[model samples]
Target: MKFCYACGSPLIMKDLEHEGEVAYCEQCRQYRFPIYHSAVSMVVLNPNEDKILMIQQYGKKDNILVAGYINQKESAEEALKREMKEEIGRSILKQRFMRSEYFPKTNTLIWNFAVVIDSEDLSQVSDWEVDKAQWFSFEEAITQVKPDSLAQRFLNNFLQEYKIKSKDFFA
Candidate 1:
């Protein structure tokens, strides 16, 4: 940030253990750490853990898992449920914490969650954020999905956990 949020003075870089070098306001004697936006990416799986939900956002060709940034006062689970409802009109029946990765391109730290919901209950939902959503089998996704992307890694991790042939991923 160019200016301090607490005071109207200019911000300077100061080393802080919480987040490395941070913006410091000399006038207010306050330090403001660079905030990384927290987002969640979910691999929505069917009850049988066979098919996975993939989505294509507007202006994007590659299909990706459902993702959204968490809002203030919202937990990771809440964000997951909200994104699912908004993107596919479905509710998560169960969820498991997967992993987290830092996305330098968006300055975001994405928390991955594996969620289970009845695929049969899914209804037709439309949103400006996404243009297409479909359930793809493990074989199909491993073959068609982008080889070098977070979505592929999430799929690989899921497959590995289920004792599926995860070695074939990106092979």
Candidate 2:
């Protein structure tokens, strides 16, 4: 930031011992380090695990996994659960962290999760954040999903390490 948050003075770059060059406020004599926002991206699967829920937001062409930023004082898992509830009104039964990566393009650190959910029918639930939502079979999901994106990386990584754990209740 050009201006210091602690004081109304111009920030100057100063190198510290542990922290590299950071913004220093002369008036406040405090250093402000650059902050990276933390976000959560999830691979949500039905109970049978063969079908994955993909969502397309307004103005986005490719369908993506449910994702959102972790709010202040909220855990990563909490954020994932909240996003799932907000996006599709479905609560995650179980979730496991897949991997963590930093996207330099967005300056965001994303934590990926593979969440097990119970609901298959999403006809009754909807969210403003998502324009459309549907369940895609594993074959369709792997093909239709965009490659080189964070969601794809997470999905690929999850599929490599774990089996599709599902128990078809109705079918």
Candidate 3:
């Protein structure tokens, strides 16, 4: 960070004990922590827990997990519900947090969860950001997501952890 968020003063790298090379504002006499946006992502499950909803956005062919940024003053759980309703037109019936991962390219810290939606709500309408969406079997979803992408990473990590935990919420 070149400038301080508090005083609008220039910041320089200063090494504090136990914290190496932090952005220090001379005018404010404080170390300014790094800033990043927080978001939420989901491995949205059907009520039967047999399938997951994936989406195609920005004209991309690869299907990805539904995700959106957490709004100001919104909890991760709140964002999860909001994103599901906004993007997939479904209300989350239940949710279980899996984990979080930070993406440098987007500068976003993403909280990942496994959420179940209403079983009777079969119809899905994509929002403007999402061009299309579809449900896939767990096996197919593992193979269908884009290779080496953030969505794929989050899905794999969550599934692996879920498996180790004997399918925490999905089971």
Model 1: lowest-lDDT 10 consecutive positions = 162-171
Candidate 1 stretches with Cα past 4 Å from truth are: 1-23, 164-171
- Candidate 1 vs 2: which has more lDDT: 2
Could you give candidate 1's per-residue lDDT for residues 1-171 as a string of tens digits? Answer: 688877779999989876888889999999976668999998788777668888888778787888899999999989998988887888888787878998888989999887887564545555677787878897887876666998888877876765654333212
Give the alpha carbon lDDT tens digit for every residue of 53-148 in model 3: 888999889889999999999999999988888888889888888889998998999998988887636456666878888889889999999888
Worst 10 residues of 3 by lDDT: 118-127
TM-score for candidate 2, please give it. Answer: 0.80
Off by over 4 Å in 2: 1-15, 18-27, 163-171
> Could you tell which candidate, 1 or 3, scores higher by lDDT?
3
TM-score of each candidate structure, all chains considered together = 0.79, 0.80, 0.87
Give me candidate 3's TM-score against the actual structure: 0.87
Q: Rank the candidates by lDDT, best first.
A: 3, 2, 1
- What is each predicted model's overall lDDT from 0 to 1? 0.80, 0.82, 0.86
lDDT (tens digit, per residue) of candidate 2 on 9-43: 99999998897898999899889876788999988
Candidate 3 has which clashing residue pairs, if any? Answer: none
Model 3 bad stretches (over 4 Å):
6-10, 15-21, 120-124, 166-171
Candidate 2 at 126: error in angstroms? 1.9
